[model samples]
Target: MSTYKLRQGRTMKSPLVNLAVRRLAIALVTLLIVAFAIFFATQMLPGDVAEILLGQAATPEAVAGLRQAMHLDQPAFLRFIYWLGNLFTGDLGTSYVNNMPIAELIGGRLMNSLKLAGVTALISVPIALTLGITAAIMRGTFYDRLVSILTISVISVPEFMVATMAVIVFAVYLGWLPALSMANEVTSITGLLKAFAMPVITLSFVISAQMIRMTRAAVIETLDTPYIEMALLKGASRSRMVIRHALPNALGPIVNAVALSLSYLLGGVIIVETIFNYPGIAKLMLDAVATRDLPLIQACAMIFCLAYLLLITIADLVAIVSNPRLR
Candidate 1:
């Protein structure tokens, strides 16, 4: 029985499993570093949180008392350690400005951001993958050139510019959609469509451009392999050869591309949310910054960093698992 148990443990120790474990460990370490950086960065920002909260007319004694009550008087390193420990227990600390639990304040805003991101991803992913695959299959044709030129043009434009253009075209010129996305006003399908229209359009365009480019590259790379060439020479149809022979082999890179492209939403959504007056975490973070709300700012920054790390880590694991050589 002991021998069987030992053999079972050995069998479980595959390279892919080892790689995933290592990747997760790395992500945890990266999160910790990011947390430290965020805490300290917020600390370095101008003006004291207590001062900001108390306002200009407050007495020095009141400011000092407020500082001590909020533990602002604590040593920076000690405060960071305390904050990090609380984070382990899911205590995000109270907002210095709002005097509310950071978690409570962020909950709804975070959900809003997630909903926006989910909608954008749902619309963008299928379109990107289909266009990318089709472009790769039709390489050197007019369709391929058209996709290449369009993607390059879109990619060259920043998200803010895209969002601005979307607002101008849809909201100002056409008057087809609202420039602002009011999350709470959506009660019916029409309301939902109106609320999501401009932001989704902007995010979709930016994210789809990147995904298309990367997906096309990955598929094209896979199609150039000797086995793919041999499969084509065996009288396989272009579509069949690509769908059956290339895509499966290229799954690792394609998944990585999708993940990396989606991760752009993290950065891009900040601009999208801000421009459209969307009630999301990014906008909340901006508000927190203006008020010098250290806890809220740190929480929002950590969330973004954590999400970005999680996506990259997942992509790495998928790449490792999907590689035939690794298997």
Candidate 2:
């Protein structure tokens, strides 16, 4: 028995490790592609960093000086290689807008985005899971129908619209929540939560909505499987039959959806972040684009891409590991 168990463990371990390595390799290659695209595309844009700096007032001499300073005169291929090399050496350079290092500018705002994402994940995941379970267990009943209708509505609504409506309702009409503010002034988590209420709700709505439908489907599907029917026939309580039997199998879909939910939550939440004027990477990227801040834009883009990839990868691995069928 011990030897058999060991062999089984080895089999699982080997496949899992190989899968992780393959995913990691794919992700690394993907990162390179993304980086190259960002570098070349930004370089190929009509306006140079100097134009961004001097605005419409730039002259031949000023543009030349600025271009020289920014090394924009370099050949495109050299510029690409230089950009990639600098990235490897931890050099993101200074923002043309503020003259501050891109990293420093991003550092402050990144924290805010992280906090918002964290709060969102903490709130939405459980709510979504719970609602999903309820819908699944109550399949064919009014409860299931009601949740399905609501989730579809929520999912269909764009996050920006939700953000706008939430602000109007909560901030304008109710006067219960603040609109468009998460400045450096939030000194405590309590204050942060209060300020973040509407944004959080808006961010979580679609995500939780997606979760609801997926969860319902996953659970319902699992319940219909023959093994679950057998468990039910054994006189398992409703809760036990669902939780112990159906939920494990159902969780695969739920996990996959949750992972995608988080992936979309990355740069995809830019709309919500923009509506709220939340100074996360989304807003940061927006600002960079408006000002044509090359370094800042590239840095922000890379950060967002890497974050999205990492979140999706982690979610995929978690989903795979948590599901017996996949394992």
Candidate 3:
């Protein structure tokens, strides 16, 4: 019997590890596809930065020199093969604008983007879960209706509109927080809180608003499951029944929603980051767009795609752990 139990344990562990490996493989393939897409899309985009920099009045000799210098004269197929080789070797290329290594430029900034994304998720997920659960538990109560209406209202508004209104109400009028910049102006934690208050809250509300709907749906579904009824019949404490039983079951869809929201956040809440001048990834990508820096644009897009892939992969792993049916 002991040997049989040991074999069962190993069998269970094997499948989980196998699932993780499969998810990772899918993520890698997704990133490769993103790189290919970015390359072709950027190539097709009109306007040669080389010509723009050198001007149309420049001689053919100058044009040729610039093309050779930038490797534009290379055949498109050869360039893609070279690009793919470098990507596999972990080279994203130098930034056209800064002449800095792609890795170096993104390394520090990605952390800041991670910071904002992390904090935003931290703030949003709990509130969404709580409201959703409460709405489910209460069912037809006034509070449930109110929460549903409020979340719907928030979901109806765009992030940019929310950011603009937050800036106007909190920063422009109430003076509760600074309208722009998460820079070194905040020397203390309190100062930072005061500065981040509007930006964080605005993004959180916008994100959580949608999450509330997803959470409500998940929890409602969990409540309807036969196991929940069995738990109640067995006289399980309400708190334990809800927290230990229903909560875990409800978490799968909630996890998926959070992963999707993180993908959205990584694009950098254009309005929120812009309003606060946060200098996160989205704003950086926008700057890349305006300047037409092909390498930077491609690198940034690839980063977002890879980040989204990672988020979804994590969500899938979590779902698998929480619900054994997936295995």
The lDDT per prediction is 0.92, 0.83, 0.81
User: Could you give the candidate ranking by lDDT, starting with the highest?
Assistant: 1, 2, 3
- Residue 36's lDDT within candidate 1 is 88
- Each model's TM-score, in the order given? 0.95, 0.91, 0.91
Candidate 2: the clashing residue pairs are none
Model 3 misplaced stretches (Cα beyond 4 Å): 182-185
Residue 26 lDDT in model 3? 85
What does candidate 3 score on TM? Answer: 0.91
Relative to the unseen true structure, what is the C-alpha lDDT of residue 308 in candidate 2, on a scale of 0 to 100?
76
Compared with the true structure, model 1 gives a TM-score of: 0.95
Of candidate 2, the 10-residue stretch with the lowest lDDT total is 317-326
lDDT of 1 by residue, 101-130 (tens): 999999999999999999999999999999
lDDT of 1 at 86: 94
Q: How big is the positional error of residue 125 in model 3, measured in Å on the Cα after superposition?
A: 2.0
The residue-level lDDT of candidate 2 at 217 comes to: 80
